[model samples]
Target: METYDKIGINYNKTRKVDQRIASIIEENLQPKGINLKLLDVGAGTGNYSNFFSSKGYNVTALEPSEIMLAQASHNNNIKWIKGSAEDIDIQDNFFDGVFSVLASHHFNNLQLAISEINRTLKSKHFAVIFNADPSLVSKKSWLFDYFEIVFEKAISKYINIESFKSLIQSTANTHVKIIDYPLPDNLTDNFFASGWKKPSLYLDQTFISGISPLASLETNTLNLIQERLENDLKNGTWNNKYGQILEENHFDDGYRFLIWQKP
Candidate 1:
């Protein structure tokens, strides 16, 4: 809880579920024509859990941080549980499906976590939504130039795409499919990458801190980067250089949808 508690306060206040992202997640869940019991690994505040529940699937939203889990909405269809990805407390082979979105990086032990995900899932149908490979971060990110240190440190924590595939494959004998997910024009999640099109959102102190990587930066460094970004936006330097990002509806910022199933 040390890791998540540091940044879980007021999480739901800034992080709202984006329908566009939700639609993609729903698609990846691959409903099997009936009510399914799904487990949301590292579920922050039951956003996705509630989404699945609304669609008639029984959802269990697991989060280790009490502060974050407390923010979740109370729904009869969705059960909120206190747990961690590395060691899930649920019974073995219980869930019809398991899904983890933007939460893998938080796992203390990646292999153990995947093993638990595999153990809990009743079958091979599972999805893990991970942020894009570190190498692809700079390709379309505006923060790379302004907050290199923050982004670099953040990238170090992410499990490489290939490495993730190997881990999942070893844990479960299933065919893994990786798909790129681009930032939508009106992305509502407010994560670090969600602000690519709306640069000003990055300058907001509260908004930036809500993102783990950016929040991990020293206060002095964070302030300096914010100042620089603010000045650039006001002086038109941001638009003059990265103006093209505004023209595009979506940018590929290293988000990938990993779906696995038995062949």
Candidate 2:
């Protein structure tokens, strides 16, 4: 959880919401001056929460990281609380809308989190975005090959998309429908694409350090990824093999977004 706080500080340095994805989410939002109340669970450093709040929505950010929560409180003009996906204590049927990002993979009890989300949002017209994806080990790439060799660990938190979907369905009442939303257009400009395009030499060392591996895994595993990245860049090995990543328009990773709506 504390790793998120480090992420919060480093977040804006590298993380900005993509405009195209924002457009999709924004379309489903309550129009301006409508005074919609919302919650951003696991809203570390108020990434998307900051954007929603800035748009005049009454957004409350709930996060468990004390350092991240503190920074979120200080940096944003929104309500900040200390909490996790499980055991969220807000009143039932309170928020008009709710959202979370990237944090679902960390949820140890997915059903409880889903139940809490369903319990807290208004009975009808509530919408959410989630994902069902597998825990992946990169075997095809030269970079990840080095990673697997050095770091004897895995990154996926038992990635099981079907199981994740079932957990949400079991907890949610009949009113909720889980639908797959198209990948947001700006995800690339915001995260992977922008970096993959820049020469590895141009990337910041600190930004690289902020990326987290699965908590259940070993830290030594990262050494493989790190060592390989360092070695390949120096030896011109990576550039020769995967230089196209910089020019690539889009790529897919394991994670995908699922939208839950109350109808």
Candidate achieving the largest lDDT: 1
- Candidate 2: misplaced stretches above 4 Å? 5-12, 28-33, 73-77, 130-138, 141-143, 146-158, 174-203, 214-224
Q: Give the alpha carbon lDDT tens digit for every residue of 1-263 in model 1.
A: 66567777757767777776777777776768677888888888887787788889989898888878777898888888898888888998888778887888888898898888888877656665655666577644576888688667766778788788877888776778888887787766788778877888877877875787777778898888889999999999988889887789877777887878633
Clashing pairs in 2: 130-258, 135-159, 151-221
Scored by CA lDDT, what does every candidate get?
A: 0.78, 0.59
The count of residue-pair clashes in candidate 1 stands at 1
All candidates: CA RMSD in angstroms?
1.8, 4.1
* Collision count for each candidate, in order: 1, 3
